[model samples]
Target: MGLFGILIVASILTYIFRDRLFSRNLETKDDKYNAARKERMEEMDRLLDKINSRGIDSLTPGEKRRLDELSGKK
Candidate 1:
């Protein structure tokens, strides 16, 4: 086989596996960010519910800090 033949085979293999490799890398970072965002939102919702059920004074300083952080106030 010539250099050109080897190059062609390599290119074909890369193309065939490209989507799988791309998706695996993409999903790793994408899913992590998505999960983090989702968890933050859920925590915020739970805090809001707690405030509604009780009162603002029901929040600890740490919970208040978290709420403020997520709201972009801190």
Candidate 2:
């Protein structure tokens, strides 16, 4: 109706939607994170399968390091 009324409504809407706006960014970040994690897990699984089929010594140095990294080992 008045300038003050419109200002109040806008402020309220901003406050109400603030979390949704911020969480949309977070959701995008989380989706990316989750997809990466899934990919890493799949890689780890494939590596483990290779180890299972061929034994650990069959792995190249890079594969070993990647396995260790995936395992969270040094």
Candidate 3:
């Protein structure tokens, strides 16, 4: 094959595999972090419901701690 044909093939392969290559470089910690983030969001939703029903001042210390942690203050 000519140089142009090889370049075209190389370009196509690079394009097709670029995302996979980059994604594989992501740390496994990212998955753990995402799971933790999702869990935190769910917890926040539950806390919000509790606050809506019983008022924010009614939250237990643990719930408040979770809220503070989420807010980056803890």
Candidate 4:
């Protein structure tokens, strides 16, 4: 194979095995917990912003429940 062809094949192989190659360094439980917490905080911020711009009643029932759930985690 020419250099270009070899490079293309190598790139494809890297893509095919990327997950397996990287899974060994997967996040620990604490990392996952922190990530989930951060996501919840972000969601709560978005909900709070909506409430500020619109009104608390503007939230859907699901959103209100989610906000409560996130808040209770703190």
The clash count for each model shown is 0, 0, 0, 0
lDDT digits (tens) for residues 18-55 of candidate 2 = 98866654457788999999999999999999999999
Between the candidate structures 1 and 2, which one is better when assessed by TM-score?
2
Q: Which candidate has the highest TM-score of all?
A: 2
- lDDT tens string, model 1, 1-74? 99999999999999999987667545577889999999999999999999999999999999999999999997
C-alpha local distance difference test of each model:
0.93, 0.93, 0.89, 0.90
C-alpha TM-score for every candidate:
0.61, 0.62, 0.53, 0.61
Where does candidate 1 stray beyond 4 Å? Answer: 1-26
Error (Å) of candidate 4 at residue 37 is 0.7
For residues 1-74, could you state the per-residue lDDT of candidate 4 as single tens digits? 79999999999998999998767776799999999989878998999999999999999999988888878952
Clashes of 2: 0
In angstroms, give how far residue 2 of model 2 lies from its true place: 32
Candidate 4's TM-score reads 0.61
- lDDT for residue 14 in candidate 3, whole number 0-100: 91
